[model samples]
Target: MLAALATFGTSILSALVPFVNLEVYLGVLATRIGDDAAAALTCAAAAGLGTVVGKLVWYWLAARSMQSQWVAKKLSKESWKRTFDRWHTTLAGRPWLTAAVLLAASIAGVPPLLVMSLVAGALRVRLEVFVPTVAVGRAVRAWLILAGVGAVLT
Candidate 1:
């Protein structure tokens, strides 16, 4: 339980601080735990939930900032507002596509989950959709990484 909490804490830090590198921490943990698959899985679960919680901070911040007078003034440009509108419309129109992209970003880090979180919030993705996709995607990613490390060590 303590280890799981530590994993969760580390994951949250990694989410907030890009240089923290949760993968490196997870790899080190995998080596220490050796073949303890249960422990590795537990850590993965914690990491998944923690990452979502941490990323949610970014989401919330972006969402709130968008409503600010300063942000509204900055976005007063017609071109910028048009771009934002196009993206918002596209995302809103294709919910499944947004979810798929979120999942891919969370797992593969192709688009970078941090950026995606901000984008989702700026575009106003529902919490009901954002949380689950991110959680499941991150969990799968952590599990795969831990499994690979265990396999290599064994």
Candidate 2:
């Protein structure tokens, strides 16, 4: 119970800060808790939930920041607007493709989730689509990490 709560808290904190690596935390937790499947699953779930919540906060902030004069000015630049428009055009008509890209980034951190989350927000992706996709991707990634740690430790 205590470990689960700790995992939840740590995951939330780690997710909010890009410098903190959640996988390393999970591996350390696995080492401490032994190779218990239930514990691993619990930790993974907690981490996933935490990640979703943290990213949502980031998304919200990015969305709101669009109204700021600084952001508006930067976006108004022709070159910047063109680049943004290109991405927006590509993503606007394709929900599934956007979701897939976001999911992949969430899981693998390939494009860096922070940037993706901001972009998704800036693009005004639906929360309905964004939340579930991020949650599932983060969950699977956490589960895989826990499983690998368990395998090595056992």
Candidate 3:
């Protein structure tokens, strides 16, 4: 339980601070836990939950900023409005596609989950879709990393 809490806190820190590197932390954790696959999984779940919660802070900030007058004025420009509208339409119109992309981004970190969280919020993607996709993706990623490290260590 204490380990889980530490992993959760570390994961959140990693999310908020780009240089923290959750993977390295998880690798070290994997070494300590040794061949305890279940423990690895539990830690992964805690980490995943923490990551999403941390990213939600970014999402909330972006969403709130979008409501600001300055942002509204900037978005009022034709080009900016067009871009925003395009993203909004694409994300809102196709929920499954948005979820899939977000999930992939969370797991692969190709487009960067931090950026995706902001994009999702700015575009008003539903939390129902956002939370599960990100949580599952991050959990899967953590599990894979833990498993690989365990394999290598053994």
Candidate 4:
């Protein structure tokens, strides 16, 4: 449990920091946690969660800051609106859809930041969707990383 927390805390940190090279940082963390299979999964999951949280902050800002000059120049209001629509659809159309997408992306080695941010932004997911989708995906991802580590170590 403590390991989970520590690993999760790492996720939060990664989320909070901008432009964290997740693979490098996660690789180092995996080494520290243990080169075992399960440990790798744990580390990945934690980082994934952090990345999601971080993107969520951005997504939230995107929702409110649609009129900012930076937002206008960088991203379109139409795009932002589309994202909210998608997120809402995910919530209404299928409650588990977001979580599944998140988990699959994690297992496939997609940068959680990229995948989560885009999806979350496009979807304009609520805080409710944000929490569980990220949490569950992290749990599964952490397991996968650890399994790989065990395979290599053993």
| Per-prediction TM-score to the true structure, in the order listed | 0.91, 0.92, 0.90, 0.59
lDDT of 1: 0.90
For 1-154, candidate 4 gives per-residue lDDT tens digits of: 5565666666666656755544445545555666555556556666566656666776776566656687666545688657655656655556467656665655554535455655565456566766666666655655555555544554
Q: What is the lDDT of candidate 2?
A: 0.84
* Worst 10-residue lDDT window, candidate 4: 21-30
Ranked by TM-score from best down, the candidates are 2, 1, 3, 4
lDDT of 3 at 126: 88
Ordered by lDDT, highest first, the candidates read 1, 3, 2, 4
List candidate 3 segments past 4 Å from native. Answer: 76-83
lDDT of 1 by residue, 28-91 (tens): 8888778888988898999999999999999999999998997798689888788778768778
Error of 4 at 95 (Å): 4.7
lDDT of 2 by residue, 24-142 (tens): 88888878777788887887788888888888888988899889998889988999889889879988968898899889988998777878788888889999888888888887898
Model 4 — TM-score against the truth?
Answer: 0.59
Per-residue C-alpha lDDT of model 3 across residues 1-154, encoded as one tens digit per residue:
7778898999899888889999998889889888898898899899889999988988888888898998899898999899888778777878899999899988999779998898898987889998889888998999888899999999
Model 2 residue 140 lDDT score: 83
In candidate 4, residue 134 scores what lDDT?
A: 67
